[model samples]
Target chain A: MIRFDQVSKRYASGNDALSQISFELQQGEMAFLTGRSGAGKSTLLRLITRMESPSQGQVIVAGRNLNRLTRRQVAWHRRQIGVVFQDHQLLFDRDVFENVALPLKVSGYSKSHTERRVRAALDKVGLLGKEKMRPGALSGGEQQRVGIARAVVHRPAILLADEPTGNLDPLLSRDIFGLFEEFNQVGVCVLIASHDLGLVASRRRRIITLEQGRLIENREQRADVGPG
Target chain B: MSARDRKTASERSRTLPQHSGGGLLSAHLEVLGDSLRRFAAAPLSSAMTIFVIAIALLLPALLGLVADNLAGLGGNFQDSARITLFLTGQTDDGEAVALSEDLRSAADVASVSYTSRSQALAEFQAGSGLGGIVTELGDNPLPASLSVTPSNREPDAVQALVTRLQALPQVESVLVDLLWIQRLDAMQAVVNQLGRILALVLGLAVLFIVGNSIRTGIEQRQREIEVVRLVGGTAGYIARPFLYSGLLLGLFGATLACLLLMALQLAVSGPIDNLLSLYGAEFRIRFFTAVDALSLLAIGSLLGWSGAAISSLTRIYASPP
Candidate 1:
């Protein structure tokens, strides 16, 4: 579960990134945050991850207020959420398996458990066979899939993605969106920030749109339409 | 999700395998292996750093060994201190022997030997290359004397014994032959103090060297560190490998220093023994005992660990997560 109450983020350069935003997503819910570039979608996701503090407001995830977490507690808090970045953020020196195993390793999972979880996640992303290959050797779509696998490898309760399909083709983007849907089906709360309006409209999921640092629309999922 | 589902998720997280004591040990061993791999990855630079550390440690160890040998030489010289009490002209050979026998019973005196006037003159004539001149003289001028070897060699105690002997009725003069030995002991003390100071200064140098080395390592792995931190890795987890790196550097450097010291000792020991033989002194060069070697290793690793801990912990905490 994630909640934001009157959240506003202002940059040091005299620019407002988010202004007076309020939203509440129930457990087991998945939503798309759609807006143009620099519409504070990344900022909102960062607030949830405790990567950046809200200038004014309370951002709550899993019933814990982000503003009150200490440095050490922030790390433990981040462990409950899986975040996928647009750039994949994979360590190029290691293979795909090692990149995906990062979350499990950080959690101190046993070697066998880590291996099993990493393989399962990689298998889910269709990257099970490429485990031995370096990220540098993978295609753009493959690297993004590795990132998705890494985000889910620890089975975090909440998953957040920022422009995860930004560099993918239409086909690859659809595949990536499908992976988030699959995770959400398993009771993981998922929030994806993307600008792919056509793809997002076709999914029939809840959509929250922003414009110029203000929430212009909060659209609920239409039950009349099934998965496209 | 329902309340039951939330409870199950929390329970599942709680059930995730926790690190047991064996797991913790394995984690450390894994980090240590990682550190060793890092060294192998950049062998030349690592070897150079270790060599620098070894040379730094070697300077102090060598100085300490020199001081130890000097102390040994001083001990030998201190044992040669002997007090001579010359008899008055009125004392006969029988009176001199009787006085030496009586002095032998004193607790402070280890041994006492009496020389008659004729024997003193003969010994002086034989030793001083003045036999012909002494024979040309009308009478033998040397006086009978008692040589007293004291059990206590401390300067103050020896001086007290000298004063006690000076009060004897038949003793014309009391001579304590210990000035050169005392000077040697003082010089040995100075050398020992200097060695300690040098060891401290060089120890600090070792600490800084390892610190700088670990700093460079952290800088090179900055991206890896960021990724680890972003994925919920603790500061200690990120620092484990670097700490091990410092430990390996110190341990290997100390081992090299020990080897260098042994080589140095072997190279010079033969010539030193020859020199000592020429002076009629039997002394052998001493190398580090097992305890000394263990201490060197312990100190080396401790310095290395501390340097790494300071450098990595500060940098890890200072940087934003």
Candidate 2:
């Protein structure tokens, strides 16, 4: 669950990334954040992860105020959530299996458990056979799948993905959404930030649109089409 | 959520039971293993750092060994610090014998040997190459003497013994050439002080070498460290591998230094033996003992750990969200 109460983020360069934005998402809810570039979608997600603190008000995730978490507690807080980056930040020196097992390793999972969980996550992402291959050997779609597998390997209660399918075709983008849907069905809250409106609108899930650091839309999609 | 999905989720939880044995010891071994692999990946840089540390440690170690040997040589000189007392001409042979017996019972005297006047004259004539000239003089002039060796080699104790003997009624004069012994002792002091200073400076160099190595390692892994921090890694967890790297560098360096010192000693030992034989001294160079090796290893590792810790702590705290 996440709650932002009149939160605002101002950069040191005299720019307000997020301005008095307030929103809430219930547990087990799935939503998509859509906006143009620099519209504060990433900033909002970053606030949830405590990567950047809001300049005003408060941003709360899983009932803990982001501002209140100590340096050590912030690390532990991240364990409860998972994140997928657009760049698919996998260590090139390691193979697919190692990239997926990273979260479990940091969380102190046993070797046997890490292996089993890594394989299971890879299977869900349709990359079970590519576990031994390095990221450089994989295609763009497969690499994104590896990132998704890594984000969910530890079975985090919440998953945040930022433009996970930005580099993929429409078909691959849809498939990536399907993976998020699969995780959400199992009671894992999911929030995705993206610019692909057609793929985001087709899901008929909740959509929160942002415009210039302001929350412009906070509603679910409908089956019927409205004005263009 | 569907019942089927719930079933799988519950099954996953059961299969991936919480890690029960997440002890600190396991964490250490895992981090240490990771550090070894990282070092293996960049052999040249790792070897260069290790060699630097080895050379730094070797300087002080060799200095200590040399100082010890020099002190041992000074001790050989102390062995000959004996006082020879010549009796007055008026003192009879019986009185000289009595004085020698008394010296044997003295607490500070180790041994006393008496040489009668005639024997002294005979010994002087035999060695001085003046037998014909001394025979022309007719009368024997050498006085009876007592060779007194002290039990304690300390300068203060020997000086006190000499003073006590000089005050004896029958003794005409006392001969105790302690100036050279005192100079040798002072030289030994200077050598020891030099060793201490060298150890101090080299110790700091060891710490600096480890710190610089770790700083470079941190910079290279900055991206990996950011990712690790984002994925629930504490500062301690992220720094664990670097700490292990520092430790291994120091340990391997210490081993290399010890080996180098031994090799150096071996290379020069033959010549040293020959030189000692020429001086009629039975002294040979000694390498590090077990205790010395253990202490060196401990100190080297400690320096590395502290250096890594300081850099890691500063880096972790300096950058925050």
Candidate 3:
């Protein structure tokens, strides 16, 4: 579960990234955060991951206040929430398997357990066969899949993505969305930040919109669009 | 939510277990292996750094060895100090022999040898290269002397013994041959002091070398470190490989330095022994012992670990996570 109560973040450069933001997502729920560029969507996701503390009010994840966590506790907190970046952030020097196994390795899993989990996660993203190939040798969509596999490899309670499909084709973007839906159906809370209004609207799920650091809209559609 | 769904959700909330004791050991081994691979990846630079460390360590080790050998030579000089007493001209050979016998029983005197006037004259004639002039003289001018070796060779102690000998009625004068021994001891002290200063300076040099080397390594792996931190890696985990790198560098450097010292000792031992033989001194050069080698290794590794720790703590861990 993730909750934000009257959260406002002001940068050191005197710019308001988010102001008076209040929202809550229950357990096993999925939502899309849609906004134009510089609309504080990325900042909101960072707050959830404890990468940046809110300037005012509270941002809570898994019943723990982000502001109260110490420096050492921050790492443990981040481990419970999976994060995917638009750039994939995979190490180019290592193969696909190593990139996907990074989270599991950080969690101190045994070698055999890590191998099994990495393979299973890679299988879900359709990257199981490319385990030995380096990220530099992969296509844009495949690399994004590797990043997705790495994020969910540890089976985190919550998943956050910031423009994960920004560089992908429409078909590949749908495939990435489908992977998030699959994780969400299995009791995993997922919140995605994206600007593609058309793709986001087609999902028939709850949508939260941000404009100039203010929440302008929170809407839900009831019609089931089924798996895409 | 259904009970099965709630069970799965609770399970997902629980993260993997922390590393066990065996797991921690394996993790260290993994880091060590990673460090070794890194060295293998950049052999030239690693070898160069190690060579610099070796040369730095070798200087202090060699200086210590020299000081030890000089101290040994000084001990020999102290042991050879003796006092010679000249008897009055009226004292005959029998009186001189009797005086030598009496002095031999003294506690301070280790041994005493009597040289009659004729024996002293013969020795002077043979050593001074004035045989023909000495033979033409009808009467010998050399005085009978008693050479007394003292058990205690301290300057003050030798001086006291000389004073006691000069008080004898038949003794005209007393000569203490300990000034050269005292001068040798003073030179040994100076050499030992120099060695200590050099060791301090060079030890600091080694620390700086290892620190700078590890700093460069951190810079080259900056991106890797950033990614590790982003993925919930602890500070200790991120710094482990670098520490191992510093440790290996220092350990290998010390090993090389030890080898260099042994080679130096072997190369010079032959010539040094021959030179000592020419001086009629039975002294052989001794190389570093096992204890010395072990100490060098320990110092090298300790310096390396400290250098890496300081570099990583100040550079990477100083910033917020």
RMSD (Cα, Å) for all candidates, in order, is: 3.1, 4.0, 3.8
How many steric overlaps does candidate 3 have?
0
- Model 3 chain B is weakest, by summed lDDT over 10 consecutive residues, at B4-13
Q: Name the 10 consecutive residues with the lowest summed lDDT in model 2 chain B.
A: B8-17
CA deviation > 4 Å runs, candidate 3: A223-228, B1-13, B84-177
Which DockQ values do the candidates obtain, in the order shown? 0.46, 0.41, 0.46
For each candidate in turn, the interface RMSD (Å) is: 2.9, 5.4, 3.2
**By TM-score, how accurate is candidate 3?**
0.86
In model 1, which regions exceed 4 Å deviation?
A: A10-16, A225-228, B1-17, B92-142, B163-170, B173-177
How would you encode candidate 2's per-residue C-alpha lDDT over A119-140 as one tens digit per residue? 9999999999999999999999
Candidate 3 residue-wise lDDT, B16-104, digit = tens: 45576666676688789889999999999999999999998999889888889887887776677778889999999888888888999
Candidate 2 structure lDDT: 0.85
Top DockQ model: 1
lDDT of 2 by residue, B121-150 (tens): 899889998888878889988888889999
**lDDT of candidate 2 at residue B273, scale 0 to 100:** 87
What number of clashing residue pairs does each candidate have, in the order they appear? 1, 0, 0
TM-score winner between 2 and 3, please give it: 2
